[model samples]
Target chain A: MENSLITADAVEISEFPHLAQKYSVRGVPKTVINEEYVIEGSGPESMLLSTILEAVEKTGSG
Target chain B: MSFIKDADRPAVKERLRDMRSDVTLSYFTQDVECDFCRETRELLEELSSIEEKIRIEVYDFKTDQEQVRSYRIDKIPATVVSNGGASGIRFYGIPAGYEFSSLLDAILMVSRNESGLSDETRKALQDIKVPVHLQVFTTPT
Candidate 1:
């Protein structure tokens, strides 16, 4: 939500079973960027930013 | 029954005291068959009571088609935290337990109208030309 180009959704896996299954969220704090890059656990801010950038790159190329 | 404990009201109020602008929590829910919708609405009500700058606008997900489309909400019990503008910060379920703190932080962040990201990170985000959707899944614990 910080950036204008980004939309962030915080989903409680227990409440949204279908989403949990679709995202294959077996752990807490699983972050899926652009439905492409998945961060299994909580990471540093830099790591999340990098993953988002990488997702953007992949989307652009594909 | 109140969703927020009485003992935590003071601390929650203190935390919300940093808000510089009015924040609106646009909550979407329906009348039936949705889990945690009532609880989420009640939670937002209790939260709004703690700070005058915080307000909630409730909408029925089944009937409020225009709002649902405008907000781009795809699910029930969704809360879009914004300061009279698009913030893109949303919670797809009840923001309880540890996630409650995140809701508060989002409110404060939007009220202040600052992302609080590092300069380097902000600079790095400028290169992006496409929309990036981030779905973070977590449990209440």
Candidate 2:
């Protein structure tokens, strides 16, 4: 979400080992939302959106 | 040789035609050690040539200290897609396969300077006061 407070980055696991280990990314196509929510696989746009929304809401940050 | 296939040019051009502003991709790489640096640069070059509003600026990761610091790029084959300014959108590898579409989407978002988020999502984001770093990791395959 560029217009919002959320910033997005597509990180290559091989290049950034620290991040990969910090998030425990053992597989490809893992999406770490806000460093709090993890979506391990690919899905529809709605699914990704809802995943972020749910995670943020649960954490009471957004 | 061109990295983008000839068949892909028409559709790629059409998608980038709607860009409202000029988008510059700041790419950082080191020649000696990076595996995907050459390919990533070539891909960005080919993609940028497909649209007038798109531009690519290549930088040496070891020598371009100012650019690396300004963009906060900590890895090789890193690309920062920005339109008006830095939008915090980055790609840490070659945008190949399905990830190519992700780069296109990022370019569109940067050109429009809008997230295209829903009203509900926007409202929720409005409540967030701190910075949120959302990282999506994926392989080229």
Best model number under DockQ: 1
Expressed as tens digits, the lDDT of each residue in A1-62 for candidate 2 is 43445667898777677888998999988998867788887876677767767766766643
Highest TM-score: give the candidate number: 1
What are the TM-scores, per candidate, against the unseen true structure?
A: 0.96, 0.82
The lDDT values for all models are 0.90, 0.81
Residues B23-140, candidate 2: write the lDDT tens digits: 9999998858488888888999999888989989989999999999988787788999887566888898888877898899989888987788777766666676555667888766
- Which residue pairs in candidate 1 collide? none
Tens-place lDDT per residue, model 1, B1-141, is 998999999999999888999999999998784889999999999998889899999999999999999888999789999987789899999999999999999999999987888888878886688889999997878
Model 2 chain B is weakest, by summed lDDT over 10 consecutive residues, at B124-133
DockQ of each: 0.81, 0.52
Tens digits of per-residue lDDT for model 1 on A1-62?
Answer: 45678899999988889999998888888999998799999998899889999999998887
Worst 10 residues of 1 chain A by lDDT: A1-10
Question: Distance from true position, residue B71, model 1, in Å?
Answer: 1.6
Interface RMSD of 1: 1.2
Mark the regions of model 1 whose C-alpha exceeds 4 Å error after superposition: none
